[model samples]
Target chain A: MRVGVVTFPGTLDDVDAQRAARVAGHEVVALWHGDHDLQGVDAVILPGGFSYGDYLRAGAISRFAPIMTEVIAGAQAGLPVLGICNGFQILVEAHLLPGGLLRNDHRKFICRDQTLRIENTSTAWTGAFAQGQEIVVPLKNGEGQYVADAETVARLEGDGRVVARYVDVNPNGSVNDIAGISNERGNVVGLMPHPEHAVEALTGAGTDGLGFFTSLAGVLA
Target chain B: MPKPEILDPQGKAVLGALPRLGFTGVTDVRQGKRFEIEVPEVTEAVLAEIAKMADSLLANTVIENYTVRVEQDA
Candidate 1:
């Protein structure tokens, strides 16, 4: 499968994401945030970054990028999309996913290897993992707290759309320890951890995050 | 500012520092952004447009609450 990775002006993780896709046996397609075309890739990954310098709130400006128009439309039409860290913020800003990512409750930029429980494995990017499986990946961000209204939170929990939850400790004070979640259809997923950063054992903390990229094979098959 | 349902750590930090600085009697502090927009004229429609902008870009309604005040022609 061909996976497209988007590079916004201030994007910091596009290269890592593209490398992860390539390592997962998918053709990597470079996508520009300023361009409207998706290049007809089967899947898309919005990598971590401080896009637009995190000005006017993280991901708020990048949500209006020319490429997001196509991404939003394609995601709505069941095109698979995975958003990581800042990409998750963009997904929320675009209203493709519910809730918002706020500043960490501790008011610090935290970087650590976090353990996450896969709560729902039906999503396009998480199908490789078993339900309730624990995986370790790097979590780094300032605005990583996930927040939503009471009703939305209840609905997400009720529908079993929560894809991952922080294990051992809630690093960012995300609501209900939610580390990641998927849209109702399970095609679009927004995860706060840097899965792309964990695709390699030599450089990353572990190879646990490789499943996020490899799962697309089953999804596209 | 963060909505009532959301936690505002920045505001809490300000509140904590206020008491340490010998200032008291202030109950709360909520850090928020203030955008000074220069428009041709302040009208009902203009205010509505500004509200739309606030809802769309200026503030994220999910965790934030924003208020627009018209500072006429200044």
Candidate 2:
């Protein structure tokens, strides 16, 4: 499988995401924000960063980027798309996912090794994990709080669309401690933690994050 | 403005400081953004257009709502 990592202005995790895909035994493709082409990759990962300097709002400006037009269409056609951290913001802004992320309740930027429970393993990104398994990944963001209307929240919970959840502690006051979610088809996933940063034991957080990248093989199988 | 259910930390912080400054009687405070657009003319169509822009980009409907108002030059 070939994985494409998109780089928007101020994006800081594209290289790490590409490396993670490579480590997972997949060829890596680089995608750009200014281009509308996906270059024929099997999957796309929107990595973390302060895109457009988070102007107007986190992920607001980047929602209109040239690449997003293709991403939105491709995602609708069942392309596997993973959005991490700032990428998650863009996904919500593009209405690819329900709800929205707002400033953390504490009104501060938080960075730490966060524990998240894999709540759903059927998604394209989480298929490698066992049910209710806990994994630690680096979570860093100021506008990381997840919010939604009462109806949307209930629908997501009832449909099992929530893919992952914060465990032990909710760092950003996300509703239901939601750390990640997946679309109805389980092809599109958006998560607040930086799994790409945890792909290697050399990075100090262990190899848990590699599952996200490796899950592609099982998804395409 | 942020939805009634959404927590507004910035407003909370401002509320915390008001009593210390001797301005007591303020019940609550919510911080929000205001945008002033200079349109060529303030028609119903123009206002509706601006409202649409606010809906799509100027505000995140999930967390905030916006209103467009026209002011006459003094």
Candidate 3:
């Protein structure tokens, strides 16, 4: 499958995502934020970074980029989209996902090897993991806290749309310990951790994140 | 309720300095924002529009809520 990795100004993770995609045996296509074209890729990945300098709000400005129009439309049409870290913020800001990301509860940027429980593997981005699998990946960000109205939280839980939850400790004080979630259709998954960074054992904390990339093979099949 | 989940460092700072500045017995401080939105001859339609703007953009409904008040332009 051909996976398009979007690059916005100040995007630092597109390369990592592309590398992960290549490692997972998928063709990697580079997509630009300023262009509306998706390059006709089979799926899209919005990688992490300080997109738009994290100004106004994290992911606030980037949500308006020309590429997001195509992403939003494509995602609505069942085109798979995975948003990681800052990209997750963009997904929520774009209303593709519910809830919002606030500053870390401690008001500090945290970087560490974080553990996450795969709560729902039916989503397109998590098809490789068995339900209840625990994986360690890198989590680094200031505005990484996930928040939503109580009713929305209940709905996400009841609908089985919550894709992952923080394990052991909630690093950012995300409500219900949520580290990631999926849209109702299950084609869109948004996670605060950087799975791309953990795809390789040589550089990353572990190969636990390889599933996020490799899972696409089944999703696209 | 001033969302216990939302940090109020700014408000806490003010509350802390109040005692040193000789303002006594003030129990708490809840800090927020104010906006002077100018509309052409404020009408029901305009008020609704402004409210929508706040709900959709100005305030993040997840962490914050806002109130709107309109006054005549001097």
Candidate 4:
């Protein structure tokens, strides 16, 4: 399968995402933020970084880029989209996912290896994992706290849209300790943690994050 | 300081209950606050000051971005 990773002007993780895709046995394509084409890839990833320098709100400006128009259309057609960190912020800004990310309640940027429980593994990106599985990924960001109306939260929980939940401690004070969520159709997933950074054991964070990429292999096969 | 949205549902609900408990003429109420400061000199020094504000508090560099407007009042 071919996977495309979009690189905005300020993106920092596109290369890492590409490498991870290759490790999972897929051909990788580098896509530009200014382009509206998907390059006919089977899946897409919006990698992490301070896109557009996080101007006018994280992911706010990036949400309007030409590529997102295609991304929205592709996601609607059941194409899988995985958004990490700032990419997650962009997904929310674009309304492809619910909830808003806010400044860390601690009023500081946080970076650490975090453990997350796989809550629902039926999504296009997580089908390889069993429910309640624990995986470690790097979590780093200043505005990582997630918030939404109670009704929205309830609905997400009821529909099994929550994909992951933070374990041990709530790093950014997200409501109900939500760490990741999938869209209703289970094709789009967004999470604040940097899974790409944790994909290699030699890098020291452990290779548990590789499941995300490898899981897609099973789906595409 | 940035202008946050004032439609805090929880805060609004609490304020709405006040009028029923004897408060009157409270037509519609909303709550939010702004902060203002003056930089002593309008020079490179002021730009530096604004940059510090952006880094420290005016915006959450990780999630939010901000714009600054400076005006001179005689």
All models, DockQ values?
0.84, 0.76, 0.37, 0.05
Q: Candidate 4 falls in which docking quality class?
A: incorrect
- TM-score, predicted candidate 3 vs. hidden true structure: 0.87
Q: What is the lDDT of residue A87 in candidate 3?
A: 93
Q: Quick one: best DockQ, which candidate?
A: 1
Please write out the lDDT profile of model 1 over residues A8-87, one tens digit for every residue: 99999999999999999999999999999999999999999899999999999999999999999999999999999999
- Cα deviation of A153, candidate 4, in Å: 0.4
lDDT of each residue in A33-57, candidate 2, tens digit only: 9998999999999999999999998
Candidate 4 residue lDDT tens string, A1-221: 89999999899999999998898788999999999899999999999999999876788888889999999999888899999999999888878898878777665699999999999989988887889999989999988888877888999999999999999999988988999998999989999998788778898389878878877877667
Model with the higher DockQ, candidate 1 or 4: 1
**Best by the lDDT measure:** 1
Q: Is candidate 2 or candidate 3 better by TM-score?
A: 2
Q: CA lDDT of B68 in candidate 4?
A: 65
Candidate 2's TM-score: 0.97
Candidate lDDT (C-alpha), each:
0.94, 0.93, 0.89, 0.83
Backbone clashes per model, in order?
Answer: 0, 0, 0, 1
Cα-based TM-score, every candidate? 0.98, 0.97, 0.87, 0.77
Q: Mark the regions of model 2 whose C-alpha exceeds 4 Å error after superposition.
A: none
Once fitted onto the true fold, the runs of candidate 4 whose alpha carbons sit more than 4 angstroms away are B1-74
TM-score of 1: 0.98
- Worst 10-residue lDDT window for candidate 4 chain B reads B1-10
Tens digit of per-residue lDDT, candidate 4, span B1-74 = 22244123334555778888998777655443334668776788787888786655445443334666677868
